[model samples]
Target: MRRSRLGRFGSRLQSRSWPRFVPRFVPRFLRCLWPDTLFGRLVMILAIGMFAGQVLTSTIWFDTHESRTLEVPARLFASRLADTARLIALAPDDAARRALAQQLGDPKYQIAWIAAKAPGVDATSTAGFRREPIVQRVIGDLIRGVLARRLGAPPEIRLLEANVHDDSGKRGGILNLFDSPMPTGDFHVQLKLHGTGWSGWLDVRANEGQADALTEPHSLALDYLVRIYLIRFTAVCVLAFIAVRFAVQPLRQLAKAAEALGRNIHRPPLPVTGPSEVRSAAQSFNAMQQQLADSIAQRTRFLTAVSHDLRSPLTRLRLRAEMLPDPVWRERLRGDLDEMEAMVTSTLDAVQGIEITETRHEIDLDSMLEGLAQDLREAGHAVSIAGRAGRPVPGYPRNLKRCLQNLLDNAVRYGERADVQITDTGRSVRIVISDRGPGIADAALRERVFEPYVRLASKEGTGLGLTISRSIAAAHGGTLTLENRAERGLDAVLSLPRED
Candidate 1:
């Protein structure tokens, strides 16, 4: 029987060593940072998105907090400044007005008299109000509004300098990223005041002045920031892990089931549970497995029926041929009947070897190969054995023995001598059987040689030995390949995986 051309092509593609696909522009380090599993990628995306949202919301809250914390202090300061402006209007001279203004201020709220010259540069002159942080902008607007309301008219307020600082003396213009703690805010201002017919800029330095309130909230705010970040991050990560694992576990189980199905036709079907899509996939896989099993059984039954039916007719033909008078005709009939019997037996063996039903066990390859070589040696075949397996392999011993026998027989019959080498490669077991025959010169024929009944020469046997051998190798989850040797003959390499 000839195998399907498409199947042969698929096997060839699988056997050939093609270069793996990789992105040409991506660096190796970046590729390594990328997560390969679904759970990892999903968690990373969720964590990053949550963190970004937290950063945005924290900034808005920080601005609102700055406005509220400074509102009452700003109103009181404006009221005091309004009272001083009226008092200065009552002073008898410029000297007295300056003196009164200087004497009326406190440490936290200082007022001084200054004559306008070039109207000296302020911090905002270079720092630019457009570039003010959200916290600074909010507080500044609130102070200006309160001053205007108290003075009965809008005052020209110039911010000379401003800064916010924490108890640790770390100065910033706003709450740091994600509401880092800050205790106090100080500002220097040059306010334009009009009294009667004279107007001048009053220099003022002031700060938000709740000593106990500011100090107490510093620790509480720090604790709150830390707790919010830590708790939310932990919760998000834990929740993401649980959700992603639950979603991906079904996929992992499905993959393992598919892999195991290739090695065992009788493996149990997948449990149909999970989401609708997952359940549908499991059902489909179970159906495919059943179809494959039923098809194989039908093939086996059909072959058995044909073999049993052909035997009686063949025996009858053989008897009728024996009754013929001519010796040449009698011998011809006998040879034809023998060939027919061999073909049927070889075909059945080929199919049976493809799927072995024996339970796997540890087999000592060293002793098995030595015993096989010894038997062939006693039978007058020039077979040589070398090397060691070193460890036992997990496989069906009888089927394994049959595979080796076919390889050895092919070598001894074609090449006149067979040299077998067994080596344990740590990861796998390699058995190389080299024959001293005219090695197949046509590279194309070497692969097709494994196809059913494919023959390189007119040997006096059914041409199914290599086919049966390769089937046995595949059943054991191993590979059997043929290659031309360097000097002469051919090498048949059988590689069996050592790990699951």
Candidate 2:
């Protein structure tokens, strides 16, 4: 049930409108989130880290700039107002005092003044002078209390201010400040005449314009930070991609070489290159392949030479045995010599054929099996072709025919009937031959049953047939397996991969 659900889900996924993009995009995005590949995961981690760092740095910069620009300038404006108040108190006459007040009121200074109290006055009247809106508002309630007693209430309130500076210290523009309503009555103050009779009028209310000096610098910094982040991110990603590709190139080459070896064991050794570790791995693989090839070649050569050398002596022995005087002795000697000769021939053929390089071509397996069956039937053996005829496969036709013949002969000679079946399994072709012969012991099923002189009590003939058949199958990128049928008899299965 679970498998059925999965199959349905797979079908749905594959049938989506943008199916092609799903495979490439989904896996990559998932890898970016929790990457399976080394390069992809590494890049993901680096990208996340860089982005986090940029955010953190930007936050710190904005906080620092806000404090420097807004808070610091607000305090400076308050200090400047105090200084202007002192200058008004020191002026000699009303004209000189008025001149100072006018200078203080200049738009560049952003200052205003209100005179509601005078120096050395009664506390009740002085309270009105201290209620100057612009100065008291800028300083706030607490600081206003301290400054009010120190500066005293003049005739009017004096305020000094200026437009906020941009990052480059240029005025941004006029800024708006809300004014709170003052207490009842427009209280005005007059300076008392000292013994000399000099007096002047004062306006005691004053304030500086609002300015956010920190904002421009903070914004500029953030902009620069964002630009730098973009450039660096791009450059780092490119460099990371290049480095990852370079690092993985050797692995890709190794995979290709491995696939080639699987297809053809005799393929030439791979060229070792890349980093030290990759080069070492390639060198080891090449060495192992060479050693395996050399070992196979050496065994084949040894078997061929031994078989060839034994044949001549066996032939001479058979001739000598025929000359023996006693009939039974001569017959016995002849049988032994013939058996030896047969073993030698089969062994030599199996060994030499294993190493024989043959040109591959397309061959109809069903046609070949039909022909073999016809030949065997004509020779008085009951051989039949079963199952569906499969598609033509590429192989050394003569070699494959010979191998099939050996299997059929074994079945007919021992089991009395041969049944051949051909099947196409998509990736490969399978040819199964079954017979009613008594199968060999299970203990020896995987033994050297293919050895030239080895044979089961219930079977006859030299035992190299299976060996030669398997070698042929292997040469064509396939395998041969032998097993006893569950009910009765033995089965030989030849599986050959489809040619590209």
Q: Which candidate is the best by lDDT?
A: 1
**lDDT of candidate 2 over 232-320, digit per residue (tens):** 77877787778777887788788887865654557767778777899899999999888877887888888878887887888788888
**Model 1 residue 159 distance off true place after TM-score fit, in angstroms:** 18
Tens digit of lDDT per residue, candidate 1, span 1-500? 25688888678767744333224453565555556677787787787678778878876775666656555555565566667766865776566778988888877778877644326733224353334565456666766787777767777887655555455656554543224333555676667755665656677777654445533456656775677777888888898889888888988998888876776666689999989999999999999989988888889889989888999998999899999999998999899899898898888877777666667788898898899899989999988888888788888788889999999888998889999988888778999999988898888899898887878665656778888788777766789999999999999999988765
> Cα miss at 340, model 2 (Å)?
1.7
**Total clashing pairs in model 2:** 40
Off by over 4 Å in 2: 1-265, 268-303, 388-390, 440-454
Residue 398, candidate 2: alpha-carbon lDDT: 77
Provide the lowest-lDDT 10-residue window in model 2.
176-185
